[model samples]
Target: MAFLSFGSKRDKIKKMIEEEKFDEILKMAVKDKKALQALIELLDDSNPGIVGDALLLLSNVLEINPNSTRSHITPELFQKLMALMERKNPYVRENAMLLSYKIIKSFPEVASQHRDWIVEGVRRGLTEGNKDQKGFLLMVIGELGLKELRPMVEELVSVEDKVILPFEGKKWVPLGDIAKEVLEKLS
Candidate 1:
């Protein structure tokens, strides 16, 4: 059956994602590792829009059923995701940060094994100019409860500026306040 051909579903899922068919992609991906693999493969897509669409689809699948979603995220997939945080496309980087946070939060044991990589991402996010990305990374750092990073996050508390945090609605929050909140949770 053509429908059951190897890589056909993954290819179809990839095409659907590129076409912005998120609802269908979500339906196809929720419990299917091949669908998940398609999303992962799209992370390296040259088109940022396609990559963003794939990331958003993965995020939706994770939110729908984190247990099943996390089970499909093997180490190689995890590494690929982590590497996207530094992608040149701001949209891709931001979405990757959000998805990475969800994955780490839902799969702590797996994330723990990638501590150095996470820390590297945090370090880059903090040092970078994108406040929105910084905000997302702060959430991950807080969830991680890395005491060693307290000082790094603590440094942001004195800055009297707001960042567009991707929370309920990409709310503008004081960077210092968000950092303070993360520090409080860490302590």
Candidate 2:
């Protein structure tokens, strides 16, 4: 009953992406906007492979030009991404978490306005996230210089293996390094 063939749809989308047609891709991504909604809907497909492909496509497009993506990333999109952080698929969750970091880094002012949400997400990741996720989260926290989060960092420091020791092997890298940097700047 459909006029456009499935292969044609696939080829068209792939060609748009390969051509770096970001605006086209974005327009399709928005619901009820264009044929691209099919691709966006695939993001929640029951098939893991389909979902993975959609997430990768979305992430790639956003990363291609974060500033351009900012306008399209409405509050609704943020909430959707935040919810995806708890997805059963680790890959999906990890990508969603990383995307959150990218968004924050790209727009610090907007992120600052949602500081509490960001902090909560980081806290959850640090507490229950797998090692890879924790390491990335630690790096983000360090970069963000959230001194007020020292108490949480301190608790992590209390754990033996969680400490990232200097590669020179001469001294252990204090978890406080991040908090210290933040406090110093504030003082």
Candidate 3:
């Protein structure tokens, strides 16, 4: 019976994703362990959209309850996230980075174990990422005080391109301004 419910739970979560009922999923994750587990399991789903939704949902869960969320991140799950960071789908990659940043903040030990990968991701994001991605990577470095990335970040200070910051409305801000801001916060 319990085994049967797991499939139903996963199916329900998939339906929610398909319907774009993210708030409902967040509420369920916060209130029901089964729902949360279903979301975690969905992270393994092959569909990039489902994986991206799972990553966003997990990151939101981490934000709401860092302690409880930390327990869900096993070594294997973390490795899966690392792989997702390299995914060609921008949504998946961005959410993977966001989740990784949140995880690094909440679970220092797990992050320290994967520090090299995290730093490399930042390096790659700066080079290959679009405006949003580059901005987020800078935020991660600044918030985490990853001073080792100072030189690489410094090189971006001269870039003149502006990025649309979603949380900051429709205004476009210079990427170099963001880089400068991160540099200031690095120490």
Candidate 4:
């Protein structure tokens, strides 16, 4: 078993991610809080490439070790992610929202603590954000608004702007479907 040494964990983990060594990264990040912190720090780096890789790695890490990461959640981390959501980079925004969903699901306290603020922020994005952002915000809203389905349906059911979400290769997901799904959750 390879142990993750401290101090250089950021560069090492970034390399491992670049090399597509997800299994190793997951093991080390799940076991070492320092490794997790390094990944989190990457989110603040000036390099968008590093930030994207860090977001991907952090989301995957949270999935693999949710129990170990409850203590890692903080208002600052959430604030950074929320800021990332407002950025123009599609990868950055999607991963940030996805990671937020993962963390909220793992710790109900996150949902209770931040759901209203997050939902409202995303709702605001629906009108003010760009195309890609509107789609991501709607998807995140779908996941977060389950308990307030009636209000969510009332507010989002008429949004037919239809953001195009392209997937790998020729695939794509329609944002309208997401809106429909959110309404369905209300039923």
Judged by whole-model lDDT over C-alpha atoms, candidate 3 comes out at 0.79
lDDT of 3 at 3: 47
Model 2, position 97, has a per-residue lDDT of 62
RMSD of 2: 7.0
Residue ranges of candidate 2 with Cα displaced over 4 Å: 1-42, 158-187
- Candidate 2 C-alpha lDDT tens digits along 71-149: 5555556666666665777667666666666676777777676667767877887778654455455655665666666
Give the clashing pairs for model 3. Answer: none
Q: lDDT tens digits, residues 1-187, model 3?
A: 3445534488899899999999999988877778888888888898999999999998998888776676677767766776776677878887887787678778888767767777886787778877767876787788777789999889889888887543343237788888898888985
The order by descending lDDT is 3, 1, 4, 2
* TM-score, cand. 3 vs. native: 0.72
Q: Best candidate, TM-score-wise?
A: 1
Clash count per candidate: 0, 0, 0, 0
Clash pairs of candidate 1? none
- Tens-digit lDDT track of model 1 for 69-155: 766677677667657766777678778877887788788988888788778767876887466667777788888887778888988
Global Cα lDDT for candidate 2: 0.57
Position 30, candidate 2: lDDT = 48
Q: For every model shown, what is its TM-score relative to the native structure? A: 0.83, 0.57, 0.72, 0.75
Per-residue CA lDDT of model 4 for 34-120, tens digit only, reads: 888888988987777778878888888887878777777987897788788776777887678678767766776676687667667
Ranking according to TM-score, highest score first: 1, 4, 3, 2
Error of 1 at 90 (Å): 4.4
